[model samples]
Target: MDNITNEEKQQSIEAFQSVIRKSENALASMKSGSAQSRLLEKRLKAARIGEGLLAARWEGKELDVSHDELVEAKQVLEGLLLMLPGFLEKTKPGSGQRTYIERRIKAFQMAVSYLNE
Candidate 1:
């Protein structure tokens, strides 16, 4: 398999950061604001942190991951999805931002599902 270049890794990190920012912004916009927003925000923060750790691992700065870290990251992504309904309902369905968030949610769900298998 071909190894990912530094530029590719950086781009992946930036994309993940953009998803985190969008999620945060969406949560902040919800008027019905529930505890779920807080939960999702916390999970998204953890996911971003996990992405950083993964980047370090990719860079050979980390030794290895234990079973627990992998599990925690999976759980964080799941938590983010669990909070999505509230935010999704608030978004106008056809708006570009809403569409982007929906796509991100779908992508995140697919990743979590793949990790679980």
Candidate 2:
């Protein structure tokens, strides 16, 4: 339990991409080119910053970040969450998607805690 396994890293990447895809679909139904939609795109990019550390695993290559790296990456993601607008937090894309993001944030927090231990 000292570090996250490669499988865990891959799972995290998959989960991240899953949400991104869901967000994309959700965004698409809105105006083709709207402010909130654009902001969601930008937020997705910011959220995916940690995926770089796990890209090799996601791609089936020979690489993955260490426990400390995972912790740092999680911190980056948490920071990104903090920077999101209050409207996005309350009711822009609606409840389900927002809850998903909130759950993902919690999941990341738990993963970081586990990796740290």
lDDT tens digits by residue: candidate 2, 1-117: 236666666566666777667777877787866898876765555445444534643455643546555555566566655654453466546577675555465445544443344
lDDT of each: 0.64, 0.56
- Worst 10-residue lDDT window, candidate 1: 1-10
Q: What is the TM-score of each candidate against the true structure?
A: 0.52, 0.47
The TM-score, computed over Cα atoms with residue i paired to residue i, of candidate 2 is: 0.47
Task: Estimate candidate 1's RMSD in Å.
Answer: 6.4
Q: Residue-pair clashes per candidate, as listed?
A: 0, 0
User: Backbone clash tally for model 2?
Assistant: 0
lDDT of 1 by residue, 1-117 (tens): 125566655555565677778778888786545787876676666556555654665665752556676677778877777887778888997997676567556556544654565
